[model samples]
Target: MDLWVAGVDGCKAGWIAVFRNLKDPAATRLHVFAEFPDLLKFDPPAQVIAVDMPIGLPERVGAGGRAPEKSVRPLLGQRQSSVFSVPSRAAVYTEDYRDACEISLKTSEPPRKISKQAFYLFPKIREIDAVMHPDMESRVFEVHPELAFWRLNGEAEMSLPKKIKGRANAPGLNQRRDLLVSYGFDQAFLDQKPPRGAGRDDLLDAAANSLIAGRIQFGEAEPFPKSFTRDVRGLRIAIWA
Candidate 1:
């Protein structure tokens, strides 16, 4: 039986995914799903799915935000800001931004406020949080593309931002594309522009994450917090790479 692994990243259109067949390296494929659950519809389901989204959310705000973000930010160094603090469960369930902010302020120990950027991801965050179950822990995991790239770059954070525009060529995007090429992905495929709503960086990120999922399937990946706590929903709160 052929084994498959996948990496997913959120995009303006929805989720962009990269799927790879472990037994047949040439069988890599790219796809777009309108929703998170749609990813599970593959004929030979992905044995491991690593996503670039916050999976486990905190029930109440701690000293910082989610523990995974705190643990991962330090390792990212210059790229630390890429790890957004996940909102608490209460805040995530709140529909209004003002209400969410108020809930976060009232529930958190240190009253950490949700950022506009973080708030923007609330719908996607909630979508994953709602669909994930404890049983899916091993099969589905959380990853950060920046951290994955950092690991691939010999643990050094890339100096250039991954989404710079207006240049003839983006060094950061090229650097990541080069790394993916080294890992056996087709350069032509990786260089192709994404669909309408998805950006080039989103495709690269999904590709990187798919590589991480492959590592995880082969027992080569590691989680951020060696010891992690589950939310009320039993989702493990940690970032894997």
Candidate 2:
């Protein structure tokens, strides 16, 4: 029996999902979902799903976002900038960016406001947050692509980045692509142009998440903070790789 697993990444169109058979890494399929719930309801359900999005919502944020984000940043080296400081739950729930920033400043210990990058992700973050709960840990896990790459690269951070000044960096992308190839993914499949509404980076990121999904399914991956925390909503606040 081929148990399926998926690695999902949020994109402008929606979510880019990469599904693969756990027993056969070469067997893969890519799909884009306009909504988060639809991804869960995908045909041939994935037994485990590792997504590159925040899963927990903390009521009061500490200095570097949550424990998971804080823990993973040190391991990412230069890529640490890719990890944004998540705001408090009240801030994340706000509709206006300014209001969200105000709430975050009031709720955080050091009075930090979320970045524009993080603000842009609020909708997708809320989208997934709305459907996730504590019990879903068995079937769904939070993953970070950089952290996954760190694990794949013998615990060393990648020297290049996926983007440089908002543009895709070919060398950096190839560096990641090479890692995926070495991880047993089919190059041809990975090389396929991303489906409409998604970017090349989105496809690669979803592919990276797939590896983490397999790791979580097999108990090969560990959460950033060995001791995980829970949000006010009981959702587990941890990043796995």
Candidate 3:
């Protein structure tokens, strides 16, 4: 059976979702983003993992003034579609992965630019993702790269506002929190027993949706792309798997 794992990160932090047998449209597992270790339970299954964040940087810049600096961007848009680039920072530093180079030339000036690759841990996920696409059918031992939103509905706008009525204490977003609740109620059927506290329910919702996105991408469920669009409620949307 096809398996899907999805991770979502917003302004503060995020959650993850896992869906099994998308073809059946009923098998799934959802977890908080911090609970990746739990994935060990299922062993190896034909899987696809999607992450919700920028995968690479637009240019290579020195980090910590070290010689081991790397290229930031891992994918580039050609005309209208995005394509993968190099697998390593050093590989792109020498123009070896010219195919993955961004069409626009950019420079990182001092002061405005950061000085450490450690700070770019999140950005490097793109490189990891570049390495994952070839085996979308492969079972991953570690957390892989991919997104849950587009996987479920294909391309659509994601507008997660910064404030919420009952979840003001929860860090990050109002819209996204609402979305989580919606998913929990409509998709996961957890609406009746929502977690207590200010943002607990919201977090649960996010985790559930992220997992659903994973299942959708794993081909366990059919995506209704024909009903979706690029933008919704003024938020820009992006998809990478």
- lDDT, each prediction: 0.87, 0.91, 0.34
Which regions of candidate 3 fall more than 4 Å away from where they truly are? Answer: 1-15, 32-46, 53-111, 115-241
lDDT of 1 at 82: 81
Number of the top-ranking candidate, with lDDT as the measure: 2
Best by TM-score: 2
Measured against the true structure, the TM-scores of the candidates, in listed sequence, are 0.95, 0.98, 0.39
Ranking by lDDT: 2, 1, 3
Clashing pairs in 2: none
Ordered from best to worst TM-score, the candidate numbers read 2, 1, 3
Each candidate's number of clashing pairs is: 0, 0, 14
Off by more than 4 A, model 1: 164-169
Which RMSD values do the candidates have, in order?
Answer: 1.9, 0.9, 11.9
lDDT of 1 at 215: 88
**CA displacement after TM-score superposition, residue 13 of candidate 2 (Å):** 0.9
